[model samples]
Target chain A: MILIRVHKECKRFISKCLKHNINLITIKSDKDDLIVKIHDNDLEEIVRLNYYSQIEIIKYYGIKGVLLNLRKYFFDYIMLLIFLIALYFISNIIIKIDINHENTALKERVNGLLIEKGIEVFTYRKDITDLNEISNAIVEENKDFLDWMSINRVGMKYVVSFEERIINDISEESGNCHIVAKKDGVITKIVADHGVTLVEKGDYVREGDIIISGEITLNEEVKDTTCASGEVLGETWYKVNITVPFAYQDKKYSDKSRYNFYLNGNYFYKKNYDHYDEEVIFKLDIFGNNFKIVKQKEYELSDLQYTKEEARKIALEESSKRLLEKIGQNSTVLEQKVLKETVNNSTIEMEIFIVVEENIGTTRMFEVGEEIDTE
Target chain B: MLDIIKSYISNEKFYIIIMDSAIYIKNYSKIINIADDEIIIEISGTLYKIKGSSFSLTKSINRELEIKGYVESVDKL
Candidate 1:
């Protein structure tokens, strides 16, 4: 841009100047004249027109103007640009790792895993996908010890938090306790460790009857109370009544399956597997939009009918399963018999008697002098 | 063909407007004479005279010129 002074009367010369479509800006300088700013390219032609022989360019603007003013401070501008680039690189480098957990051993273990995955200090920050994968891998590797682990990035630092897994155990449980009969059964055996043996083998004990007492007895006087550490194996009986329909449908799953998803989850297009069960393998919600992946296991159905003998056999097996579920895995199904059976057109009902040998003992804590059974 | 030429001629007709202290001229092809108090410009085939005081003409897009001054008279010759 070019700025020039023009006499007021010659403003008509401005009109003559306009006849050529020259881009210019006019500012009223005083009562007698004005300053006209135009493109530098138009100055040569405007001067050639002979209307104004004295159009002096007072100052430059635009790129040309910037260059004219910045020529003296070029080095400073270059140094500033370099400083900004260095700041960008420094901001992205990981400087410190903060493991925010109470367990120092667990913290060190997690730090080792993180460093193994290139997540230590003074390294470039990993992308979001890599960080998420590393978190999942570490959690899966130590599933028994770690309940959940999360790694989050805050500026140039990595912040980690986790929870340790806790499990329940049965030893000398429920302090100051006695091993009582959990079921009304005949005592088949007794194994005592820390408590006074109350019932002998082959004794008929009722529910809530103590098999081993935590109180120490001395000449009809009580001494000290301790948790009973023993198990009482007994013979128990159960009469279970069951009814099952003779005609039933059985489902068998085939190996053919398909994956399905929408939204942020990975796109997968498999052939549609019809008549199937859908299991969601992965799911995450983002801003109320569901991203999901489903595994479809296709199943085929077959109709089956059981005869009277077959029904009886199945009923006995089911009865054993039901009994074990109640008495736990250490029980043995010693005997079974069907006492009554009633059948209709499509169903069979039966009352089955079953005998099981199981350890019928669970701890029940007691306070001092709570019926310590004097001999 | 004739309609297109006629339409072009009508569209190119010069127009002049006088308001307060300014005169606006459109489709002016040349400035035959100009001074502080008076200016003559050719519009189409006719010559138009603008008599005013302290005339300053500014040309913008669409061949439109704005002249600002004390307007006395405008005539076509």
Candidate 2:
């Protein structure tokens, strides 16, 4: 049917050409554009006489006159060709990767793992497949941390969502154990369940000291043993030693910089310079081919001297940061003070004291025939 | 029924079909008159005159033609 239509259109175009006294033969009609073979002699006459009907020779059998006619739209045709090629390359790549998770740490870990497996942003979609298999493999690899995981593709982006495994403390409930002090602290509160309270409130306890005993005595005789589970809130003190340097190095960048581009793992312009920082200005990756525009700026490091007051402030902040690292989460900072400060050569040294209210008890299991040590 | 049998027997000759606002003609000998509002076609020894508004010979080949427009009348002369 299409061939018949084309043949009919060709005949009609030829007949129209004859009626206009234009010596032309119809080659084909491409939708709206009618491609015709016209004699060189009649071309000028056709152009002058057929002002109402637009005609152009698309191709010539033996003459180069067609190139002159196409010269008007040569640049437009070239741009259209380039645009089509760019579109084809862009459509095959994954433009974005979105991990659906609330925890930033877990998202970063998953993103890193996906990148290792060759499924990342700007990667070709055709290169990654078997999403279910990959998801199962990832879950298996992180079996201790992840319970469920799934990867889905939406347009050019891969959406990853996962569930982390929550480990439950079942040993405390199952074994006969005593709650001992994890660290040396003064007991502020104590709650003992299914055991005897060894330490009362306001009592000072040492590390490894049992705050709650698992033994239950009846008629002043040992009768039963159970898991002693409770919260022993204590006032813990931490002493952190910190040193802050009086002189610190600051980076000073030069105003001069050079620009370069990299395409497909090869640099368009290459230069080697030490102590230079590269800032990426633009980046594009299509079908595994990467393009990057970068600015290289050179810099030097110089020491800047700080005053005594500034050094003390810096030392205090450093000490506080160190103290926080030692203290576990869910602990309340009750009070903090700089116990001692001394100025050394080119450095400020200080000792910090911090008091925190925290859970200072840990469960320890005992064998059936084991004797209890009271030390 | 007689016309159907006759058409089937003379199927190799010229065939003309008049549809809504379109005319399909096959085995046409020549185009007598071509214009924007009317067209005259010859098939064998007879001339078929097609009158319409804004008429156009949209498709034409050897011994075939497709006329498209707001067809007003078709007569055999």
Using TM-score, give the best candidate's number: 2
Query: lDDT of each prediction vs. the true structure?
Result: 0.77, 0.75
Candidate 2 on A160-179: residue-level lDDT in tens? 89999988755455668889
lDDT of 1 by residue, A22-68 (tens): 65555444566657777788778877874544555667788888897
Show where candidate 1 strays beyond 4 Å. Answer: A1-176, A219-225, A253-257, A262-274, A279-282, A327-330, A364-375, B1-77
TM-score against native, each model: 0.43, 0.58
User: What value does the TM-score of chain B take for model 1?
Assistant: 0.74
iRMSD of all candidate structures? 3.6, 5.8
Clashes of 1: 0
* Model 2 regions more than 4 Å off: A1-72, A100-123, A129-141, A172-175, A189-197, A213-226, A249-303, A326-341, A351-357, A367-370, B1-77
Shift in Å, residue A102, candidate 2 = 6.3
* Candidate 1 residue-wise lDDT, B7-50, digit = tens: 44676576777768877777777777767799898888889888
DockQ for every model, please: 0.09, 0.09
